[model samples]
Target: MDGSCDDVGGERTALEDVGVLLADQGLSDAFFLERGLVKYGDAEAGNLVVVQVDEDGREHELVTGAGEAWLELRDAAQAEGVLLEMVSAYRSVERQAEIVRGKFLRGLGVDEIFAVSAAPGFSEHHTGRAVDISTPGYGVLEEEFEESAAFGWLEENAGRYGFTMTYGKGNAYGYLYEPWHWVWG
Candidate 1:
């Protein structure tokens, strides 16, 4: 990935580009920008990218992981019959900005907004090192997915593949506890 805004045609680069841009803009303390995609649980830097077929049957290409951690994780989940599926991945910086703006408009305070939205150029999706996985028939990150055998298997084995949960209980950094999200280290 070029990770440049030009390639994205002013749509803002992927989350990785946003992270880099934010670092250049001096918001380093707010969040650490991710570089590439990885499994949803890897602690290494980067955003989660995934490929998903939406309910509309549209194939969406997501930027995630620097290599094959995502594939391995997906395979592991499948081997266990966990029924894993990706919902969203590799969000562009422009899209992230829009999400932030939407949240702001929806009454999220400045701090609250930043807590969830990457301040442009400071996102991980640019690196294609992150992923969002869920069980089939589950709407997004449903509670069942969070507690399902697939999730548990990942939690127990993702680290071996350099993947870690991006957010979960007791995590004080970046967004809320998203059981469905992971990153490759």
Candidate 2:
């Protein structure tokens, strides 16, 4: 299949194409590109964002929730000498749209941009379960998170917290590789 062309055999929408972009960026697992999978806010109200400090003393964020599992994960990280901080949590679809537009101005083409930029209803950020982690001094964590220690740590342990890398290795999705971003189901 051509990475730039739409998946004719699949029912994926343009929004999912954006998810492919995210996967290529390393924001999460590529599997997220699968069609019809619900993310963040479904009927469970379990979407949240959490922050953490890396060995470099830099702050980072991931999409998560304020549930007990999240707290437990935080506590575990703290016990291991990891400084976890809570950054922004639960973003609205409007916020996600703003991000999509900004990405376009940054030189992302229509296909490279999420379909949400054109239609807000398809945004993963709207689910509030997806987060744009903050890599202080690194601009948006989307592209550079891979080189950050905070993101690496999360990659190793986020699954234990019910959080997973929405775009990453072994994923067929084509988003760029982002070491800093993550999502909770």
RMSD of each: 8.4, 10.0
Instruction: Kindly list the per-residue Cα lDDT of model 2 for residues 1-185, writing each as its tens digit.
Output: 23543432256543454455454455542234364444433333343444545467654333344345556766777677654444444455444544653574366765566432322344444555554455344445446656665566677887887777665654333445544445666
> What are the TM-scores, per candidate, against the unseen true structure?
0.62, 0.51
Candidate 2 structure lDDT: 0.50
- C-alpha displacement of 151 in model 1, angstroms? 1.1
For model 1, how many clashes? 45
| Lowest lDDT block of 10, candidate 1 | 35-44
Alpha-carbon deviation at 122 in model 1, angstroms: 2.6
lDDT value, candidate 1, whole model:
0.57
Q: Which residue runs of candidate 2 sit more than 4 Å off their true CA positions?
A: 1-66, 85-88, 102-108, 115-119, 134-144
User: In terms of TM-score, which candidate is strongest?
Assistant: 1
